[model samples]
Target: MAKNNRTLLLIIFLLGIFIGALDTGIVSPARTVIASQLSISSSSSVWIVTIYTLAYAVSMPIAGKFSDRYGKKKVFTLSIALFGIGSLLCGVSNYAGSFSFLLAARVIQALGGGGIMPVATAYIGESFPIEKRGSALGLVGAIYGVSTTLGPTVGSALLNLVGNSNWGVLFLINVPICIGVIITALIVKDEGIVKEPKKMDVLGSIIVTLLILALMYALTNLQFHDFKNSIASTKVWPYLLAFIILLPIFIIVERKSLDPILNLKYFTNREIALTLLISFITGAGMMGIVFVPQFGENALKLKTGSGGYLVTLMAIFSGISAPLGGRLVDKYSPKLVLSMGFASTLIGSSTLAFIVAKNPSFISLLIGLAFIGLGMGFCMGTPLNYLMQTNVDPSETASAQSTLSLIRSIGVAISPNILIGFISEAGKNISPKLMTILPKVTIPGSNTAVSMTQGGSSSISPDQLAALQNADVTTITDVLKQFSGSMIDKFSPMLKQQLQNSKLPKGVTADTLVAQWKSDYLAQIDAIRSSIENMFQSTLNEGFAKLFIGAAAIALLGLIFTLLLSRKTKPVSSN
Candidate 1:
């Protein structure tokens, strides 16, 4: 490969990853605005974000292997065009008020965006020389870090410009940028030249996709359960069972197929196995960091914008740390650097766990959140370096990097389900009784918990009850919830007074006992809310600490495993 050509491929590869990362986080904030405008519930609108992830997660490995059979340029250009089309479709669909159509548009975007990542990453791994692979991958990781950090703030700000209702404008904005990339891609020539005798693995692709869908669905339900709805209860099992049935079939077909969407043999390689595992763990860790905003809310009760900034803090730290870690991998061993990255995450996570309650500056939280990002940055660069060290053939670089990308996506793919499951488990331990009795509760939302109902009381005669009974739908829940809460508080005193007039159970009046019971209920309810927050907060903190610590540990493990590669070092093939 010529030097100039390699540089050009690198530019295109970076663009692809940057664009893909930008899309991943951009939808999170404005999704709520989009939901109401389209007359759909938030749950339905969630797909607008989820479909992108699912598409990317399932399609990456397939796209990676596809680059080998068809030329890399062809696959890369097609991916860009598809993503651009998806983006264009989003802008046009807003006119029809069709959420389903909008969803389909999202799917198209996902399909395109999903294909872009692996191919782009693969292009980097293959085009960059062996010695410079770590730095090359680090550069890609850095761009991703910057784009991700900028996602929410950028997306929200953009929405403001387009009238928040113009959410489609975000998608439409991609078209021109994508067109530029595609035109550039067409001018670029294919870099990874191999004999064209290999066949595509059609059945393996189908099965792997099915398996990913099943896993993604099962995990998503677990992470982001609908506590109010019971349908969520039965949603997980079929997918889990189907995944169980499908995985083995996928393994068998891939092992036997002339060509597989995923090459099963790669897993047999120590570095490949370890790299994929690292990617998976990092992905999970990424999800946990994403929730730092929630912690800011639940524990500290900060404002909307304030809580969301926690994630922004993390992105900033991770973005900076990723390139630094990549340099470490280049200068030192992958193991030491990866371990440090993981350690940072663990420390940050542990710190977040001890938080009980007290409003802190959003800056302090950002500082803490930055460490989580730092840890992620430290870890993400490992697989690219590791894959380069492990794979014997230059042509296999695409598969290795692509597979790592896919596995890492597993963390994301499973995040909604993972966090949902964590919340559910935590919720079960939390007595719902607290929810009914607490002074106020935060609705399902940002880091800061807000009062679900107001504390104000109306002063009106008994005649008002009849009049308020037929109030508008908007006031019904607020009135009913608040009225019920106040009535519960006031009921004991009124009932006790009435019982006194009736001459209750002699020395053991039921009304007096009832008053005590209500008092106890209030106490218990307050305790429940406090305990719930504490329990989940501690658990998540501890879990995150361990997760980061594990990332470091995994890095160490990778270091040791990398030693094994040294023992049987695969000579870098001369370009």
Candidate 2:
């Protein structure tokens, strides 16, 4: 193929991957709009994103294996067509006001999208000269980072511009892009077929599908807020158990198959196994970015939509680092580049855990995020792909890349369940801790003081006390404010009763004492409110601090794994 033709093909492939990744997260901001328009519950509407992810993950290995068996060009164009059609159906489903149909359409969209990243990555691995491969794959990482980062923001912008009723436009917009890519793809010269294409691994494919489906279904059902209880629930455990049972069966079946969906032999190589282990850790670390906005909301007290801008900051850094990391990979070795990436990740995650989480300063947050973004750009993109591509047989490039993607996704899937548990556990402690710190109110012109904790003569009403006792991190601030107001209300009548029953202090008139009492009460209430707010905020800071620590641990593991990789990779021959 001519160099110009290859460049065009790379552009076309990048576009395909860009749109695919965009749709993965773009639907997030518009889920409520979609649910309200379709008359579904918010929880039910989540299935729109869930189903798509489920289908996308499940289809990955199959798509990569298919690309390997068929030709990358043929599979790539067809995948685009499927995605375009799926997008069209998704738009129409919105118009028709059928939630079920919309979910079905999303499944189709994901199936197509599942093929894109791995296959395009495989194509680049095969077609690009080894020297240029890192740069190209780095661009892939950069594009993916930018798209996923922008997905929610772009979705929100689109919804605001088009109005909520025109939400279908999000899906419909993919049609033209898909068409352009497909047309360009078809025009590109055909990459020659494999000389002897292995027979389809039908049995292995079925088992792999069942295994992933079982696993993802269980993972998706887990409620991060109630991690322990949720994991124990029927919604999570049974499917998880099924996944465990099916995993060995799938591996056993794959081992016996003449052409396995995932070639088991690859695991025998220590380098490949280590690369994948590092990739899994990298994926877990990547989830820290996903929760950055949530971290902002809890620790920094940032408004909801503002978190996207914080994520955008990280994405920008990742984008810059990706191409830079690629060039470095070309200049030195993937091992060196990967080590640098993991080291940056360790620094970033540790900063977030110890500094940003405690201080909740935007500048510190930015510093933490920048390092993580650099780490992600290095670890997630070219170096890993380059490593995998070089280690694998050329014929199995797509399959190998797909396996890498699938494993990383599983890590992404699992990290939230564990990391969010740290936050949730902290939240559970707020109510008990708040009870011990509940303020005591003192009446003016009298020595009498009433603890909010006591049942009799307390300022807090029964309902307000209950609210305080049950308050979690999210509701604690509002509950405190409401209770503070209630305390004042209840105290006004109590003060009047006390003043009526008891004589004023010597030379102090009733009017004078009343005024003094009012002044003293307000001061006390202000101090109490400030104290309670600080405690609640501190507890939340602890929760988020733990979340970052968990991420740091993953990044640290990634850094450690990079040490095990050989200093120099054995370069794969272009010919």
Candidate 3:
């Protein structure tokens, strides 16, 4: 390939990754609007993301096998076309206001989107010489990292610029880009690396797909709030049982198949197996990156959207470190580079778990984030892909990359439930604490300080008070804020009625007493609101601290896997 052709190919690959990853998060900001317009419950609307993840994970190995067996260029082109068609359908679903249509369209979109990364990666691994491979693959990894991290921010910017009515533009905008990529992909000459072909392992593919789908389905449905019950429920256990039953069946099928979709040898090779394990741990650690915004809101009490800016800051470091990490891999052994990466993550997550989480501050958070960004840049991309590419045969390069991605996706999929379970369990006392506050709150504006529990004397009715006590931790702050306002509104009318029935003293007018009462009442309500907010914030802080602690544990596990890698770098094979 000419230099210009490689550059164009790289550009096309980057664009594919960007659009696909961008869509992964782009729907999040608009989820509520989508739900309202489609008349779906907020909880049900999560399926849009859930279904895409499941499809994306399932398609990875199949796509990789297709690229390896057929050709990268052809599969790349087909994948882009599928993605484009899916985007079109998604846009149409928005117009039609059909949630089911949108979900089906998302599955098509994910099938294409999932294929792009590994296939593009196989191209880079095969196309580039060993010396340049790290840099090229690292750059690809950086784009993927940055794109996924920035997805929500970009979505928000688009939503703000175009407004909610134009939400479909998010999906529609991909059509032109996909068409352009497909055209370029068609024009690019396939490298035509040949190997003796065998029959496609259709059964192996089916079993693996079913196996992954069942496992992911179970993980996605695990309700963090009701963890114990949810695990025992039909939503989780049935799929889990399916996965367990299918695992041995998949192994048996792959073992007998001459040309398996996933080469069983990769698992048998100790180095590759360790590398895959490390990749899984790395994916779990990367979950910290995803939750950074929520962590900011919970721990630091940052404004709603401002947390994304912190992610942008981390992305800048991640983007820089990716190429730098790749360069380091080219210089030193991968073991050394990987060890350094995991250590950085361990330090970063520990800082968050212990120091910043305990005493939330901007400066402390920045220190922790910087280390995490550096760690993610190092571990997530170049090292893992480089190992997979080098370990497997050229014919299996795409399959190898896909297998790596599939395992990592499982880690990414599972970590949230585990981390969130910790947070949820820690904050279970939030409602009880809130109930204590409600009963004890005394309104000072009354002739005698009145208890909030005194229904007839209080502006807040008993039913409304009970509702506040039952509020979920996620929405308690907003619920309390609204409750405060409604209480004040109710107080004004109630006080006005009281004044008409009361006898006034000589110097004081009923109007003056009413005004004073309103003033005092507002002050009291504001104080009460502040106290409730503080309690909620405190609970969140405790929850997030545990979340970060769990993340740190994952990083530590990655470090252990890093230690399990071959101490010496193997010379690149010239196959």
Best model number under TM-score: 3
For the record, the alpha-carbon RMSD of candidate 3 to the native fold, in angstroms, is: 3.8
Candidate 3 per-residue lDDT over residues 1-575, each given as its tens digit: 67888778888987887788778777878888788888999889989888989999999999998888888778877888999999999989888989999999999999998898888888877788887788888887788878877888888888899888778888998999999999887787666454467888899989998999999999888866677899998989999999999999999998899888887778778888898899888877888777788777656666666678888888888888888888888777677778888888888888888888678888988898888888888887898998888887787788889999999998888878778776666566665566467533333235465443345425566776666655543556556556644665566676767766777777876667766755564465456776777787677677777888888888888888888888765634323
> Candidate 2 lDDT (Cα, whole model)?
0.81
The residue-level lDDT of candidate 1 at 82 comes to: 89
Name the lDDT of candidate 1. 0.64
- List where candidate 1 sits over 4 angstroms from the true fold: 1-5, 223-234, 298-301, 355-367, 382-392, 421-575
TM-score of each candidate? 0.75, 0.86, 0.89
The segments of candidate 3 whose C-alpha lies over 4 angstroms from its true place after superposition are 298-300, 431-519, 527-534, 571-575
User: Where does model 2 exceed 4 Å of error?
Assistant: 192-195, 222-231, 432-479, 483-532, 571-575
Per-residue accuracy of model 1 over 159-230 as CA lDDT, tens digit each: 878887688887788899888888887786665744264677889888988998888777666634454352
Candidate RMSDs in order: 9.2, 4.6, 3.8
Q: What are the lDDT scores of the predictions, listed in order?
A: 0.64, 0.81, 0.80
Clashing pairs in 1: 219-417, 222-417, 222-421, 223-416, 223-417, 223-420, 297-447, 297-448, 318-373, 342-552
